[model samples]
Structures are given as structure tokens and as C-alpha cells.
Target: MDGCALLPVNSPGHLPSHHEVTRFHCHSDSEDEYVIIELEDLENLSVAPDKRSSFEPGSNSAEATAQELCRAFRKYWLQTDSAVQLSDCLSSSKQRSVRKEEIPRELESSLNLAEEIKIISKLRGSSGWSPPRSQIIFNIHPSVKRDAVVAAQNFTCVGCGTPIESKYIRRLRYCDYLGKYFCDCCHSYAQSSIPARILSKWDFKKYYVCNFSKHLLDSIWQHPIFNVSCINKTLYTKSKEMDRVREAQEQLFHLKKLLKTCRFAESVLKEFEQVPSHLTEELHLFSLDDLVKIKRGQLLPLLKDILKSSTSHVDGCELCQAKGFICEFCQSADLLFPYQTAKCKRCPECKTCFHKACFKYGGCPKCLRISARRTLSETPSLVPQ
Candidate 1:
């Protein structure tokens, strides 16, 4: 999992789902009316903006035509609403019966030997997931209190809605993330460090998770989805160790900026490319896997290895070494760089580098120059006003 490549720099946009289209019905609060509308139906109702038919053809005045068009639309809506209601009722009942009979008992039979029978079906009719899949998951909902809620579910597989009554209930395993029971085929004792548990409680304990949840967690293992600063600032405040790792991540992030443009450091850059972008570029962003590694004290050593490799390349290569900053404040003979956190510190305002001791006395020379120019330019305005 450590070798997992970072997600594409340009994340995929939400694609229009080609799979399913539920009958769109808008119920008016006051009118108490609804009619099934498909995506295609809206296209037929809409007139082209450039076309004259958008307005009533007979009426010459724009205002009068618009009023007539509105009245006609209202009439059309009411007619369609009433007409579809009667026709849809008879077919709906037959569809419900058909769906019940179509429930596949293979789900339970696949898990264990149960003398395959179509005894259990979802109380509600569901064909499949109809909505477009989400790209990112920001929040993992906490585990439900199973002792209170699981009893009410009446021993059912949450994955396929298979009823697990009597001895069959023993075949089901509980998923920690969703707090629901599923057959061994769905749960399979697959363990994942629950995101909610880690973020909220800082608990690294892996729990039995369903296949869907396990796969979902694994997919974003390398993506920088978590922002520790914004999502949980207290994580740093409470855990001193996490704060240290964060500081190292910040140092690596700043150092990467230099090596990115240096052609001579291509060898180191190519090797370091295996490191997740979050570690090198974004300071705040972290993946769930990163948090687990941080707690286990493996991340800092890995980062140090990255720092050493890049630093050694920069020190030796003349092209990369020439990019270092000299102390402007002290006019020091030695070269300074942002990554030299021990000897050099960047000015917060202008980001000009200086010797650690020199920065305190001289402040930022670039900032002072900018301030002087700003004051001189404002002098004329200040004199008059």
C-alpha cells in the first residue's frame, strides 16, 4: 500500500450517470399534483432561444405572448399530471410483484450451504444503485450503536437485504464502520481502520468492515483527502508526536519546491516522485493511511530518507546548488536555502532567506523596501487628504 501511486493531479469531474433514471415527479405543496418527468421530456418542452416559437405565434406583443405561453404551460402540466396517474397505477402493482419474485437467493447460497431458497427479499423494491458515484468521501459516519439498532433490523444482511433468521444469523458478521450485519461473503472478516474512529478518537484499531467499506477506504489510501489543520486542529494540539510529523511534512513540502525546477536534480526528483504529493506539495492534506503510519512512527523515518536523498543531490549538483540563497541581512559568504531549517529561516512577509541569528535583528530587507515605496507613493495622497 505504501507503493500506491498518488491519484491523478487533475481529479475526474462528475460524469452524468448512464445507468438509471427514476421517474422525476415534482409535487406542488399547494396544488397537490405530480407527473412523471424524464430528462428527455424537459428537452421536448423547451423551445430554442433563437426560435420565434418560444413565444405565442398569434400575439405580436412580447408581454402578451409570454402571458399566453405561461397559461398554456400550466394547462399542459395539469393534463399530463392527471393522465399519467391513472395509467401508472395498474402497472406499478404488477411491477412490485415481479420484483419480489425476482429476488435472487443466490446471495445466501453463495455464502454458505443453506439449501438455496428465495425466502428473504428486501421489504422495499430496489433494482440497483441509481445515483452517480461520488469521487471523494470527506466524512465517515460513526458506527451505529448495534446493541440498540441491530435488534430492530431482525437479523438481516445489510449488503443484499438477505434475511438471516435462526441459525442463519450465526453466518453474519458485524461491520464496524456501518454497524450492520452482513453475510460472510460481504463482510468476510476484512479489517480496516475506521476513518471515523481514527479522526474522532485517534484509535488505530482495525475492525471488521464490509467489502464495500473496505474497498472504499483502500481506494483513497494515497489521495490527500484529509486536511488536518481544518478538519481537526486539536489533533496537533493534543498529540505532540503528530505535531512533530506535521512539522517534518511542512519542511519536506517547502524543500520540494526548490528541487521541482532544478534540472540537475532530476535523478532525485524521479525517485522521490514515488512519495505521495501531499507529503511533498500540500502541507495540510493527509490520507487516512498517512495518519495510521504517523501513529505507528513510520512516516517520519520515511520522510527523513526523502530529505536525505534530495539534499545529497542538491549539495553535489552545481546546477541545483547554485539555486541556494545567500544571507542578505549579514551578507554572509555561506549559501542558505529554505530546507536548511537549522541555519536559515525565511521571513514570513517577503520569504527572503537570512541566517537564523541575523533575521531577528535586520527583519526582512525586501519587506522594508516595499514598505518605503508604499509610504512614498502615499505621501501625496496623505498631504491632500
Candidate 2:
């Protein structure tokens, strides 16, 4: 009678059997409302505390009154349990929702709980619950889609073989030559952490220079030209070697322009024009007479040796001992000396010292010859007929 106390059959505490009818209060709060429930009606109700018997409330039988009371208790318990469970679920959902910030900006607006759960499942295995397929709307990037396809085949990072997941796919970077996808961490290390010696061996065309800017390309040509032997020994890939050679040729072309500005160099270049436009072909075809004249003539001192100076002296003359000859006009020691065997030239007219390489293309930067600019017909061809 008080606060959900169950009445047992044949107990002394219950209403005496002589009393055919008893008044039962459904709830403690309402003292005015009382239902007439009989002892037999209580006994007829099922044993389960929450289950309500089918006995109808409107029926004229004593069991009807008992059924009404049982139904009220059952409804109260069900509502209480549901409210508690829902509260717990909401708290858990809030915790899981915190990860939404990590999603890419492009996908943020369209993301939903169902799609999030699906992505989480893919990354960290299933959580034993799956939402309907129609609810999941994926609008991922092309790169992510490609990664997903690759992950389906390999199930791991292409570079390190770590298990591929949705999170990793979002941050992945690709290597074209390697033809594989790498994790973000590993890709970053490859770009900045690798040693220069090892990095030099990588294919410049395929891997390194693929994303080069115009400034970077020009810088390659502007930098001091490396020896062919050095480049050949260092670069293992054919593409890289070709890139080095091409850059070196471009640098040489620029150097030729500087040479043409001088009257003496202009004359030497005019002599060179008869051989061919390409320097490599002309070098191969040069006769012994040409070499003899180039070595001994005043023109030898004008050709700048662009090589860097070495600290130690090797076998040869003062120009060779200096490692590289300097150009007086440029006032920089960075000029290249092509002939290692040649000697330095001191101009008798100006008493200025010049490298053979510098004098060959152009006389001293200060001494311009009016005759050096004579018409091509007036200048005799250095090539033997």
C-alpha cells in the first residue's frame, strides 16, 4: 500500500481473508484516489514486478482493479529506465563528437554522425554498430579517393608498409618515380632530412626537379659548373646526368654572351663559328693546329676559367696552381680556366696579368681592339681548307 510494496497471498500482514474487498492506493502522493482491489485480485496478478496482467481496468470483476494498479507501476518503471539510458548515450556521443575538428575543411559542412562513425570504423575497426548505407554521404578529395583505392589493394603505406587507415589516407603524400604513396611523416623526412650526397643520386628530372620553379632552373645554370667527371661519378640515374649536362650547357651559353661583349673574344668567336653552333661537336673536331694556336695566342688569356679555386696546388703553371683564373673586368676569382696545361699571360702593352682561357675569347677587358671587329671576310678562317 505504501511506495510499491507487494502484497503476498495468505500473509498475516495483508487484509484478513474475511474482508472480501480492500482499498489500495496506487501512488503515495494522492491520498484521495483509491481503487477497490480484492485479495483474490492481488493473487491473480502475475509474479513479475514490472509485467502488467491483461486483466482489463473497466471490467466489473475484482481482477480488473488489480490490473489497473499493476499497469500504472509498469509504466512508471519503463519511463524511468528509458530516461537514464538516453542520458548516458548523449554523454558518450559528446565525447565522440570532439573528433569532428580533425576533418578537412572541405568536408566539414556535409559531415554527419553516421559518416563520422563509418570513417572511424574504417580507421579503428568496427564499433559493433553500423548506420544505414543511405545516410553515409562521402565527398572526399581525388587524392583521398586514389589513396583509398590503393589502400584497398595493399592495406598499408607504400613506403613503410604501416597499416593504411582513413586518417593516414587524408594526410598521405605521393612519390611519382617510386610509384607509391607514403605516409605524411615519412614524406616530410624524405624532402628535408636526407643527406645531400644521397639526394644528388635521386633522379632530378623524375623526383627532384619535377616541381622546380623558373628561378631554381636559372640558379642551376648560374652556379659554378661542376666537372663532367664529378657529375658522372655522383649521379647514378641517366635522367639526372642529362639534367646536369643540360644545365651546364645553358651556363656555357650565358658565358659565351659575356665573351662576345669584348672585341678580342668577338674575333675568337667568329673563328669558332665556322666549325658549328654546338660547342661539343666543335671541340671534338678541333685540329692540332687550332689547339696550338689557342694555347700560344693572346686569345688564350681572355677565356675565363669558371672553376672554383682549390686550396692545394697541383702540377702546372701559376694559373693552374691558382686552381681557377680570375677575370679583371669581373674582379671575381670565380672565372673558369679550361686549359690546365696552359701558362698565364701578362700583357706587354698594359702590364696586366690574364689567364689563357680569358685572353683566348677576348683580350684584356680594358684593351678593346678596333681591328678585332673586322668583317668576317677580312678575318682569315682558322679551319684549314
Candidate 3:
């Protein structure tokens, strides 16, 4: 109750008294009500008697500089800390960006996906719900092909040109991900599941990877670079768990859109601090980290928990509830959101949500209208102009 007191009562579910709401508003509003509180705090600071002077000519240079910096910080915070745009607040932020190694200048750019990520991570963050999965190009090297085998054979280390002393004595380590050879110091016999093999062939076998490739993978483990819908649509049919997780992710995506747009849902967003951020920020994209979680059978449960909390917030917020969809098919009084998996089914073509039972009878009205419009446009006029 005390923590909830910080925010205004947009729609406190069962609160019966205006008195409590008034008290909370008074407590929070008290700061604003006392406009000179900050000034008074400065005046009342407990300065040592010896250091204090009754009539000081002016504040010292350090004090002036500190006041200026404080003002600037305050201005910046006020400008950015409102109901910010979804893009501005929800953009993908990775903890580390792989700095290109001088020895292997093309290490980060060796694969198309790697290069694309470098560009994206460097540029101003994208504003879309999820990056287009179709645009992600995976460069998986064929191991057995003659040309591929021949090209991979290098007399020197791929990292630093450290030549092999003897073929049998000190063999070079082959990195499956980069399809290159490295010396002992550069390789360290590190092994990890390759993203290329995972995305293209759905293979999860561990293989030897160079230190550079391992670090690179680790850095982008949580970056949304894979688009299973575009890359391997058949995987969903093959893996029921993946499909389920995808559906849950879609629901969370819809929920995030609502929570982000509602001006009264700021505290609700703060609740997401302890959870995986990718679930809310990117809709259709999956990170290597997410894939790992799915492999471990842990992603769905986590997503479900997130979904429960997010939906609860959207339902409780009056501003978010105002935007809820009324079932056009049955004309039901009940308000529906696309995230309500039990109640609503979203139209694949037009992306409209309706009660599942109602949809079974009426079909998608928007899709039918679109089809009719298309047919009318395609048909030629019988009479000449």
C-alpha cells in the first residue's frame, strides 16, 4: 500500500475511500506544493560555525560549478523522464559492443549477421517493435564441399599469422562458426553451439570456436538477431514448444505496446526492471540468449509470469483499458485485447482481435472487406469511357 501510494489512483481496483487517495496525493503532491522547499533545504544546511559567514560576497567557483551541473542534470531529467516515446525508452541496449581486433579486422564483419549487428548497434536505435527477421542473413559455411574445405586450409593462424611448426606436433584449432584456423593462444580450444547451424539447420551440437568468435557470441547473446518466422518457418511446426513461446511472446508484445503508450503506467514499467527486457522491446525477434532459454524449457514459464503481470497492469490502468477493443463479431459488452489468449483470436491478415467463439462463426470481417476491395480493384470496367 505504501509503495502504491507513490502513483495517482488511475483505477485502484477495490479502493472504497476517497480519503486514502487524497492522503496519497497530498503526500506526493506535498513536494510540489512547497515550491521553496529546495531553497529552504540549501539555506538550512548544517555548515560548521567556523566555515560559515553571515555575509558572504558570493559562492565559490566550485559551488557555482556544482550548481550549474545540478541545473543541467535537472533539465535533462525533466525532458527525458516523462511518458517518453516507445523508441526512445525501449530501444535495445547491450552491455558490451565487440571492438574490432586489429589483427582480425574482419572478425566482426566475417558474417553478414555480425556486420548487420555492428551497424545496428552503432546507429541510433531502431524504432520498430521488432527488427525485420527477413533482413537477417545467416552465412553458414558448408563443411564437406570441396571448395569450402580447400578455402579453410591456411598455413598460418587466422588470427595472427602464427605459422604451424609441424603438422603433427602443433595442429591449428578449427573454429566451426568462423570456418577458420587459429593457434593455441588465439583459440584456447573454446567450444560453443554455432548460431549459423542453429538458425539454418537447427543443429545444437557443440563445436570448436575461436576466442574471438566465443567473445563475439557472448557479447550478442541477448541481441535479437534471429527471425525464425523468416528464416525457418517450418521450425514452428516441428517444435511445438517454440511455437508456444512465440505465441506468449506475441501476447507480451501486445501488452508492452499498451503499457508503453498509457500515460498512467510508468510505475508498471518500473516493475519490469528485474525481468528480461527483450520480451517487451522486440516482438518477433529472438536472441541467442532467448533460444538458449527455450532449449532449456525455461522461456515459456518466464514469459507467462511476465504476461500475467503486464496484462494485470493494462487491465487496471484506466487509460490503457480505454483503448480496449470491443468484439465487432458478436457485439459483446466485454472489452478485449489481443493479448488475452483465452478470450481473443487475432486475425492473421488484418491483425484484429475478436472473441474466439464469435470469430469461428463470423470469420474475419476486416479480411473479407480487404479481399473484396482487392477483387473490385482488380476487375476491369465493362463499359468503355
Candidate 4:
């Protein structure tokens, strides 16, 4: 019999192999009097295949035992003659006979026929067996278009290009305009990152469209900033524009607060004064116009010097130092100073010099006032690194 016909929770009593058969039972009866049945787990059986088949051909006692058991089943169920030839031996009736034939040899002499029948019933009940349903039902969404989302994301994930499998492919939900099939991970990224933009602009009603647009935009826009090939200059320009907007907004906010406190503006000035001499000299040219008034010129230079000093003091690159370049870092080549003929500004410890681009990218060779004060106050230091 096909293994698929044998369900997990319930199985037919017919042994799937020539292996030992333990228990049997009728599950469901049809109009034709043939009842579907299932066999119990074979592990509990005491019959030995080698011993049963090993019996001498003329062992009439074994055959007689089987016939007597057949008579019992016929009297109880089949209602047919016990003396008939074993014409239908291929049917499940053989299993009932198999059970009865083993009892006298396998059971202890103390156990009676009633006890053996009881044992068979108990084993039959305990063995997991059931009838196959005539009709199987699945409640999956008929028009759901399961792979719709995955196909929306594309065969490969939009967020991370993982190739989708067939099972998940059909199950994936599609977003038509996004033109991609979203795996769970990319789907979640689309949901969180994309929907957030939508939530900010509109409510949930247009979420699908907004989310799809957002996902599409991300797919189109996401690319590495600086690659040897395909540098994505358009994205780079937009990113810089965004950075300018953010920086301008922050400076406006900071300046507003600074305007409220003379001490704070004075601190900004003091920080500007602390810029190293070489950088100061290059920047001092802008301070020549005293005609603007000492305070106005001072403030402008102070702002310029602060930004320049911050960039210079913070950025360093390990890569440049390793390459024996003093005035530039390769990844941050934009930070390289325009005046290569000019003096070099090098970090004290790393002995590395950096251009404006390198300086901005290098993080910080020296701590700035905001973070320095924060670290010194919050963390305990053993001494110095």
C-alpha cells in the first residue's frame, strides 16, 4: 500500500511490509461490508517472523490454530463458514488470523483465550490508527495571490538578494508596483522603513501605495557611496544636500541658543582660539576686514575657525598612515587639502596628516568640547591610554 495512504495519527492495520504485525482494528465500515482498518505500532508484537515462517510445511497444529481463530472471527464478524479455503487470505482478515495464530505459542500457558482477546483489544485501541477523510479541506485564501508580494520584490529579495525557494515563492505576498517579491526579512524592512514615511505624511488608508512607493524608492536609491565603478554620483549629491540641510538646521538651532547666552558664544570663540597655529594662519586671512566691526568679523572667523578646527582635530585615517601618506587618507580623499604646497596638519599620536575631506571623515584625532566634556565627566579613567 502507498505510504501516503497511511496517515500520521491513524494508519491501516494492513502491515506495510513483511515485518511483524501487532494489533488491528476496523476503523470505518462501507456499504460493501469491507471495513477500512489500521494496524497498531509493530514494536509491541511478540511474534517472530523467522519462527512463524520456519514452521514445517505439514504443521497442522499451527494451521489448525489459525483456522480456529478464523472460526471465532467468522462467528463474531464475517458470519461465514470456518472450513472454507483461505481464498481471501490477502485481505485484512489474514491479520486477525495472524494475531490468533500467535497467541498459544507466544502467551504464557496461564493466560486464557479471554485474556488474549482482551490484550488484542487493548493493543488495537492503543495503536494509533484512523480512516482517511473522503474529503480534505484547506482554508487558504483562494484569490490571495500568495507569491504576489515576493514577485513584487523580485525573485531575489530587494533588501538582501536571497534567492527565494518555490514553497516560499508561492506563499509570498506581492506588491504590484514595487515589482519585487519580498521575503519575510525584506517585507519587514519594507513595512517598518517604508511605512514610517507614509505614517508621517498620511494615515493608514493609503499605506499600501505609500509603502510600495517607499520600497521602490529605496530599491532605486540604495547604492554604495564610493565604488571604483558605479560611484552613484547622483545619490552622493543628494546625500550631501541632505547633510547640508541637517547641518544648517542644527547650526540655526545652536545659534539660536547661543544668541541667548553670551557665555556660550564666548565658549565657541574660545574653542576657535584653541585651533592649532597652522590652521589658524590659513583661516586668519578672512579676519583682515576689521571694517566689519571687531565683533562681527570676530564672530564670522570664529564660526569658520570652529568648523575648520573641529574637522581638522577630529579626522584621521589608519589606511593613509599605513600607505605612508602624511597629508591625505584615500577613502576620504575629498578631505585632502586643496593647498598641497601648504603646511601639513598631522595628528600628534598617529603622526598622520589629513586634508579637509580626510579630516571630516577621520572622526576625531582630538576630542571636541561637547564630547570631551561629556566623556571626562561620565567615565572614570585609569589614567591615560
Question: Of the candidates shown, which would achieve the greatest lDDT relative to the real structure?
Answer: 1
Q: State the lDDT at 325 in candidate 3.
A: 86
Candidate 1 lDDT over 95-167, as tens digits, reads: 4222222223113213322222213213322222111111122234334443323333434555544545555
Q: Which stretches of candidate 1 lie over 4 Å from their true place?
A: 1-147, 151-157, 162-172, 183-185, 200-202, 234-244, 292-298, 316-318, 355-363, 377-385
User: How many clashes does the backbone of model 1 have?
Assistant: 0
TM-score between candidate 1 and the true structure: 0.54
> Tens digits of per-residue lDDT for model 2 on 111-215?
454565455456543422111111001111223345433433243443334556565465555533223455543344223111112223331232321111111
Candidate 4: list runs displaced more than 4 Å.
1-190, 194-230, 236-306, 311-385
Tens-digit lDDT track of model 4 for 318-341? 332233334434444333321221
What's the TM-score of each model vs. the native?
0.54, 0.18, 0.52, 0.17
Per-residue lDDT tens digits for candidate 3, residues 132-224, read 011111445434432222122323444443434444223556777666665565567878887766765667778887665665455456656
Q: Please report the TM-score between candidate 2 and the true structure.
A: 0.18
Go through the candidates in order and give the C-alpha RMSD of each one to the true structure: 20.3, 38.0, 22.4, 33.8
Query: lDDT-based ranking, best first?
Result: 1, 3, 2, 4
Task: Enumerate clash totals for all models, in the order shown.
Answer: 0, 24, 0, 32
Model 4 alpha-carbon miss at residue 337, Å: 5.4
lDDT of each: 0.53, 0.32, 0.51, 0.32
lDDT, candidate 3, at 299: 80
